[model samples]
Target: MNPQQPIKVLLIDNHPLVLDGLKALLETYSHVEVVGTAGLARAGLEVALRTQPDVVLMDINMPQVNGIDAIELFQQQLPGIRVLMLSMHDSREYISTSVLRGARGYILKDVSTEEIVAAIEAVARGETYFSSGVSDVLMERKPDENATPLTIREQEVLRLLAAGQSNRDIGQALGISAATVETHRKNLKKKLGIATTAGLTRYVIEHGLN
Candidate 1:
């Protein structure tokens, strides 16, 4: 058989076992090549800079810096590289945060190897991918009443802000950073034209979003 063209990939996760398993699984795909692995976000960033992988599979709950943070950083540094989050948690906050932070795809760790490979390939082609369960959760929420409806991530950030969480707390809870939370807050305020905390609270209550 003629050799298939390989898609370069970088795997990032704090756990060695998870990284090893993912590397092995991805290698099974004829079109995928595991170029490198990193145990933390910073190391992953360096690897990405050097290897310029077609796709990066990132784990969300890593030490020091998480996948969401890495996505923003990597996108700014290497605009051409695609980041596909590989996470164990399917929480609304986690999935929404990754999407908002510029992740091209989100796949659960428990997904089959075939699905994971498909997700990586799809993302490398500049498409979005979500595991079946993650897609269901994302689709469960109906759009808000506002004519210019907020995205899933913006809505979640607004809800958390309305509940009196600080930016740092929101970041910690959502696996993002304080700067990202602040940026989302600014965008929400601009879009909704509601700047004050009281105003946001009132808006949420008026719209029955709470």
Candidate 2:
């Protein structure tokens, strides 16, 4: 492959070993260029802005600022740069947050090097990609899948509520205000057509929201 046409890539992860391993794996692809790497979200943001890479492989858990928050910030700063979340977490919350934050792809850290490279290439070409194991986490819930539509935040609140957390607890866990938690609860109830907390709990149980 011609060096002049290589696809530029930026990698961000808090772990040094993971960063080094990813660099090694990605370098084997002759058409890909590892433009830069960072171990913190702030440094990643700066590198991304300065390098303007075609794709970013971002880790979900980072010191100082998380990958989901960084994704939103990077999208605002560098519109059109594709973000591919690479993380050890396969939980719905992390996957959903990535999509909501404008990430074009999500892949597990354990995925094969070939899949990671494919994900980066696909995302850089304006296509969405998800690791085979994580695809279900990205599926948009059908309108009828629930009784009504829930905003992303409301769904997050609902999931936490179903885990038997108090409003104050949920607020602290989500970094939101207790009053905001109450508002979310009200909105969830209204949208789901539930009249009571018992009803909400039942809905959550039925849908496996927890």
Model 1 lDDT vs. the true structure? 0.80
Model 1 / residue 58 / CA error / Å: 0.4
lDDT of each: 0.80, 0.79
- List model 1 lDDT by residue over 66-99, tens digit each: 8888887898899757889988898877876676
Task: Please report how far candidate 1 places residue 125 from its true position, in Å.
Answer: 1.0
TM-score for all models, in order of appearance? 0.67, 0.66
Candidate 2: tens digits of C-alpha lDDT, residues 1-210: 233788899999999999999999899999889999999988998999898899999998887899988987887789766889999999877776576556777899888999998898887777777887787554443224456567678878987765446799989999999999999988887777665554454455346463
